[model samples]
Target chain A: MYWEKDIETIPREKLEALQLARLKESVAKASSSVFYGDLFRKIGLDPNDITTLEDVRKIPFTTKDDLRDHWPYGFLAVPKDDLVRMHSSSGTTGRATVIFHTLNDINEWTNIVARSMYMTGMRRSDVFQNIMTYGLFTGGLGFHYGAEKVGALIIPAGSGNSKRQIQLMQDFGTTAIHIIPSYALHLSSVFEEMGVDPKSDTQLAIAFLGAEPHSEKTREKIEQFYGLKAYNSYGLSEMDGPGVAFECPYQNGMHVWEDNFILEVVDPDTLEPVADGDGGELVMTTLLREGMPILRYRTKDLTRIIPGPCECGRTHRRIERIKGRTDDMLILKGVNIFPIQIEKKLMDIPGVGTNFLIVLEREGFNDLMIVKVEVQKEFFSGDLKQLEGLRRRIVEDLKSDILITPKVELVEPGTLPKSEGKAVRVIDNREE
Target chain B: MIAYQLSIFAEDKPGRLAKVTGILKKGKINLRAITISTSDTFGVINVLVDDPEGARSILEEAGLTVSMKEVIAVVIEDRPGGLDRLVQLLLENGINVGNAYGFVLESRKKAVFVVDVGDQLEKTQRVLKEASLETLDAKALSAIEPFHYMNY
Candidate 1:
């Protein structure tokens, strides 16, 4: 019933033993790269010295800047001819972190993603429609290969074209779909516009929602709208994307595949491991990747390990849904807030549309946060008092939720910018 | 008395008004009367048009938030006291005009005052009738040719 059952349900001690051996092999592979090789030799560290998982801390943490400083091929442990494919970040901030995968790495990644899909109850008979972008973004190809490996008829529906996506769902008896959570909400409106009730009209039984951090409420909203169970899939391009962790049928927390990744939750400031079940920055060490194995790469994603064994009979430990990226945290008026918190609060309020923008600006020396929310079309009926009341209520609600009174601006529906890729929720124009 | 008016929510920025008018012009929908209500950062434009449903759909398709609202249109004298009298009559009763605009049909002789009383449509029409105001229905409102004199 399980994919790679022996490894997936291995005893705790056996799993640790497997992880340590793989971790040492991965460290050796990572040390072959110029970046890690130079750093390890300079720091007087040897890959052979890492006898225990705790010894992983002895190796310096690899930062995104280090990757950027090394640029194009500094992290490649194999020869250029051995590399099969590469995926990259958007690189809006600086140099993009491009991860290369060898044929073996690709095979391993595909297997993990296939295992993840199977865990979510997708079978070979299922026709999977992947609605995430396919280019340099790992979400598309990662899920693409996995669904193919699962022997499902894959529709490489690479995002955006809501009408075409709906048409595909109807035309191809699409049983499963992989989409971002926000887009799933947006697509529901399109389905409404097309006069098709997704619940009754299509054969969508399973939805794999990821590529962005979304709350349980968002997942519940998508489930209610689309009439399908949406399992959360988590990964970043630094590690092979979209299948690093996935929710099983239980749908509680995503089981981090311990056989492939050595996961750690660390205090972002001190770089010390946080106690189990406590929130901190998630650090991952690649155990099976050969092309570009990274040791203790800080994902910048903040989440906690779910302390108990999954009821799904999988022995791999689970991690809570990502709270927010450590970099995406906004500090205003001495209060630290994540955009997801604002999204959760705004989404709960009636008449607030699915899209919003949190704009941070500086007026003189003080920081100002202005939340521009889209008022639903039905609610934008020029009722001056009612509109004012909604604005006031939003301001009050946000103030109570985030502990900072923000200027709430209600715009017409669909006024905020909609991104086909990952939605840019925050725009900070404050001068540092 | 189901006169339709296209109420559009707009941001108060340069060229925004031009953008709305440009869309209507391109769509071949004629605007009969238009009024803008502004706040600090945004405004709402209520336009009386010959084809309100057509205009609303086109505007909405063009990414503008347009809502078709039913309003009351009344013919009144174009003299200075014409609007004052109508406002006085509505106020004498408890009816509040949520939005109002006027266009002169013939200077000093006749004009049309379009008023939006929100959900209190029946009460406002009753008050207007009691005051002996000549209100135009949707047919008459759409048939109005501004500044073209026609003997009654």
Candidate 2:
């Protein structure tokens, strides 16, 4: 019944041995890259030195800054001709982190993604509709290839156009969809606007939600709205997106593929591994990647390992859904949001003032981020509808840039609080 | 043009209109006619005043968004068909009235309609003149003493 039954159900002892073998190969492959080669030589390290899983700790943690330091080709383990594709972060904050894949790497990623979909109970008979953005972003193509691999009827419906998306679902009788949890929540309103209850109107049975951290309450809300079982999927571009881990039918926690990568939870400050079942930073290493192999890469995502074996019978360890980031990055509605990114968007608009605040609150089970900006005195002289048009334009621009629609509240100039030192741009009221 | 109207950007909140009228009162600007066009959150207040420029500058100085717009003052009989006749003529001529307000100048014989024809101010005046309708410009509008009823 499993996609790779033997590999998936391998005993703990056998799994560890497989991981160790693949780990050594990955280290050797990574050493061929300029950045890792220099680091390995400086430490006088050898791939053969890592005989057991514990020896992986000897490798220094690779941070986002290191990725930035060696942009474009510094992490290339293979020749340029061997590379088949690449995916990258939006780089709204700084330099975008990019990941390259060889043809084999793509096939492996596709297989893992397919396995993930299969674990969620998606079948070849199902029509899978993928709603993530394609090109440069991994979520789109990652799920696209995986669903295709499962022999499902694939509809590569990119993000937005809510009406058309609904039409396609109704016309094709789509049985499955892959989308961000927040967008799924947002689409419920569109369904309501069209007088269609997703629960009774379409043939949706399963939803794969990822690309952002969401609470269990949000998952339940999305499931209730869409009338489908919502599965949590997790991945990062560095390790290949959306298939690093997935929820099985049991839905207790996400099963991280042990055959592909070594997962670790470590204290962010100490750089020491935390005991299993304790929350800390997620660090990962690629075992099967060919184009580029990352060792001990700190994901900066905070999650804990669910200490027990999953009921799904897969030997893969399960990681709890991500809690928060170690950095100031806010994942609002499944899109990475930085206060500075909002600042940049506001500064680009002519009538917007310098002082702005991002207020995040929870409306029902979904998170709502409202960007309150001051309108210049001169701009306030327009007709009431003109001001409204300006507000809508700002909202549209910000949504296009960040992929999450934010409510733009235009306030009078000098109304928002000013600061002398570093500005406090984000006021999170979600906890309240 | 004999009549000028001040269009002030206003938010739909209690005391917002008071704030605008308060500023005009402080400036001693007499309000001849006023109409508020509102949506959900914000609105526009179109006001015919004795001194349009003075009202605009003072309202702007008080931090209210204010602009001066030209409008035509039409004098019609204060009877049942007076407004209908004027509106029908504008409709037939394809002239859109962007903003309009009216005030009765006498008990039954006279009323003044302040119409902001937007960019069609000249064409609207021409249409009114050809139709033998009496129209007033800024000078005649500012000189009107409406409260004191006189025989037409």
Q: Which candidate should be chosen as best, given TM-score against the real structure?
A: 2
Instruction: Provide fnat values for all models in the order shown.
Output: 0.27, 0.23
lDDT string, candidate 2, A173-234, tens digits: 99999988767877888899999989899999999998877779878888888889999989
DockQ of each: 0.27, 0.23
User: Would you list the clashing residue pairs of candidate 2?
Assistant: B1-B138, B2-B137, B2-B138, B2-B139, B3-B137, B3-B138
For residues A163-203, write the lDDT of model 1, one tens digit per residue.
99999999999999998765787788789899999999999
**lDDT score at residue A326, model 1, on the 0-100 scale:** 72
Taking the candidates one at a time, how many backbone clashes does each contain? 0, 6
What is the model-wide C-alpha lDDT for candidate 2? 0.85
Q: Candidate 1 i-RMS (Å)?
A: 1.6
Give the per-residue Cα lDDT of candidate 1 at B142.
62
